[model samples]
Target chain A: MADLALGKESSDFKKGLQAGISIGIGYFPIALTFGLLAKTSGLSIYETVLMSLIVFAGASQYISLSLIAYGTGIFEIILTTFIVNIRHFLMSTSLNEKCEEDQLISKLIYSFGITDETFSVVATKEGTASTGFLFGVISVSYTSWVVFSGVGHLIGANLPQTLQDSMAVALYAMFIGLLVPSMKNNVKVIVLAVFGAIFNSIFTIGHIMAQGWSIVTATLLSAILIESAEVIKAKYRGAGHEK
Target chain B: MRSEIVWMIVGMGLVTYIPRMLPFVLFKGKELPPFIQGVLKNVPYATLGALIFPAIIFIQKDDIWYGILGAAAAFIAAFLGANVIVVVLGSIAVLALYSYLL
Candidate 1:
């Protein structure tokens, strides 16, 4: 029985590795960009690799590099990275319900590997993923990011300026890809986004924590508005039915 | 000189780990309310929108026209129900070319 269980676990690991590889495939350009940026920011290869391994957040890492390159204060960089990543709190909160029971170790291990791409892919899985499967996905994504980042660092300044310029589209493309799937069922999302963008723009004029706060407010406000609308609509419908 | 940078990077890593790890620990055994869950469900999309929406039109300096162009691209593509990749690539292609030219 022990041997059989061990075999199952190994296969799960293999499955996870495959999933990770798939994630890595999508991560290619972003990780490469990360490498380029880190090198340009004067991060040594070892330092760049460590950041990829530790922070493991593509957008936040890029933002951090920009901050460093601009000579932004340490406190501000840390604060900004934290604020930008605050959304993960919600992602993990939702994921907690679906994770394996009594598997705190697995949750901790896998949570570190969470990314926008990973969360989108993994959250859609049907049931509680085995600890092994979780690691499989994380390992694949993590290794791909680190390896490609290094490749970028090594190829630093050698990459064509056009290619570097073009890669800026990757993040937007990835987000839109993720958005298209959901926009179909949710009109509230459209409303929220529009209002959020308007708010963000207005705040940008004033130079507030416009980037971070605009998003947080828009999301919260739109969500609240939609839910309230639903409740009111349901009440009116009930009244009409009674009449 | 670079070693100092390495220390900063290391410090960043340590700090980032806490946020990633804390949620897993605090929410481990319990279930949250449905309202909270609903709110949480929408955050990823909300976060993505916030991050991308502003930058779409206004590249760097106060550029209102760019914002309109971006919104138009997203609106048209989304209105036509274009696939995310197509919409993304099309918008970027259009904008990048437009921005470079203008």
Candidate 2:
């Protein structure tokens, strides 16, 4: 019985690896750009690669690079990173339901691998995602993210000065790219983004706060304002139905 | 300077790990309140928006179009439902060409 179970586990692991291929491939350019950006932003190759190795969250890492460039304080950067990654809470909770019951250690091990892409893949799988399978999926995606990051840094070092200067815009382009699709799908997202941008501009231009604090404040305020509006709208709709 | 970067990365790693791990370890089968969930859901979009603006225009101080045009390319690609990689690559391609022409 043990032998049979081991065989099944191996097969499940293989399946997970196969499933992760697309995510791994998708990560190539993004991770590479992140590495390049880190270098351009004045991070040492060691620091750049270490950030990828440790943090492993894409948007937060990118944001950190920006904050670092602005000479933001360490504590502020960390707080901003927390705010950016707060959505992971929801993803992790939802994934917990989809994943199989396992030892706490096992759950802990695999949870580290959960990202937006990995969560979607695992949560959407037809059956409960086994621990081995989660490992399989994360292994591929993690390897690509870490490896390509280093590669990008190396490439950045070799690029001409002019191209390097222009590459600075790619980070913002990446953010716009990520936001546009969700904005198209949900009007609320558009409102949230616009509000966030407007508030951030006001704060930044007025010099009311440091750059890091400005972003953190803008994000929290916009989220709260937009979601409260949504809730109020929903309540009014309910009232209208009752009337 | 090096130590500061290390501490920052460590701090980031902690904050990041907490969110991804706490729910798995602590919550057996519970859901957050609807309002909290709604706020959390909007956080990413809000954060993204905040990150882009103000900063985008300042990317190339000498030539604002450098930033605007790159953002336009990314917006178009993303609007067409391209994946993250394509959107990034598309913007890069556009900016590379723009720079080359200049």
Candidate 3:
């Protein structure tokens, strides 16, 4: 009986890993670009890979390259990355309901591996998600991110100087890669991007604060403005319907 | 290793880790306020926007047009729901071409 259960668990893990294969592939270029950009930003290869190993958040890790380029302070970089990742709080909260009952330690380990992609894949499974499956999914994804990040950094560091400098453009390309998919789906995303950029530029030109802080401040203000507008619009429609 | 960089890496790790793990650990059987959920949902758009908008236009100081072209390629590729790696390589391909042509 125990042997049967173990076989079932192993199969579940293999299935979860199969599900994550696409996500792992998706992470490759993003993580690679992050590594390249980090090298361009003067990070040691160790520093570049270590960031991925530890932080393991894509956009935030990529954003840190720009922050480093800007000569932003360490504290500001951490703070900015934190704000960028704030959405994970919501993702995790929703995922809690879907996660199967397990030891607190199991939850702790796999939760650390959660990224937006893993969350979506695991959360959308047909029924309650097993802790073993969660580990299988995120472990593959996590390994891809960290390992390819190192691969990118090593490849980047070996490139000639001119090519290395040009790779800096990859950072903005990375950001656009992130932004466009969402904007295509939600018009509100377009507004947020348009205004957020305008606001951050104003702050940059005005010299109101450091660049890292400017991004953080502009993002918060834009999100708040748009979110409030949306809520108010929904309220207005509801009231109008009542009339 | 510089002390500051070490601190920064560890700090960023904590920031990302906490948000991911906190809810699973702390909210075993609870729900959060609707307002907070609403805000969190928008965080990605707001944050990605703030990172990209004005900045993408200026990523390359010498030839701004290359940056613009790169953005266009990435935007289109992602808009079509191409895999994220493909979206990135698509932009890189464009940027590389612009460099060669110009």
Cα lDDT tens digits, model 2, A31-114, are 888989999999988998899989999989999999988999999999998987876776676677667888899988888888
* TM-score of the B chain in each candidate versus the native B chain: 0.73, 0.67, 0.69
The DockQ-derived docking category for candidate 3 is: acceptable
DockQ of each: 0.35, 0.49, 0.48
Give the Å shift of residue B62 in candidate 2.
Answer: 3.2
In lDDT terms, which candidate is top? 2
| Pairs in steric clash, model 1 | A16-A136, A20-A140, B57-B66, B57-B67
Q: What 10-residue stretch in candidate 2 chain A is worst by lDDT?
A: A157-166
- Estimated TM-score for each candidate: 0.73, 0.63, 0.62
Question: Residue A1 deviation, candidate 1, in Å?
Answer: 9.2
| Tens-digit lDDT track of model 3 for B8-75 | 99999999999889987787543557665565455555656666666667767776786677778878
Q: Give the C-alpha lDDT of model 2.
A: 0.80
lDDT of 3 by residue, A195-218 (tens): 778888898878997665676677
What would you estimate as the lDDT of candidate 3?
Answer: 0.74
Model 1 spans > 4 angstroms off: A1-26, A66-76, A97-102, A123-137, A192-206, A235-243, B1-3, B58-102
Model 3: how far residue A121 lies from native, Å: 10
Q: List the residue pairs that clash in candidate 2.
A: none
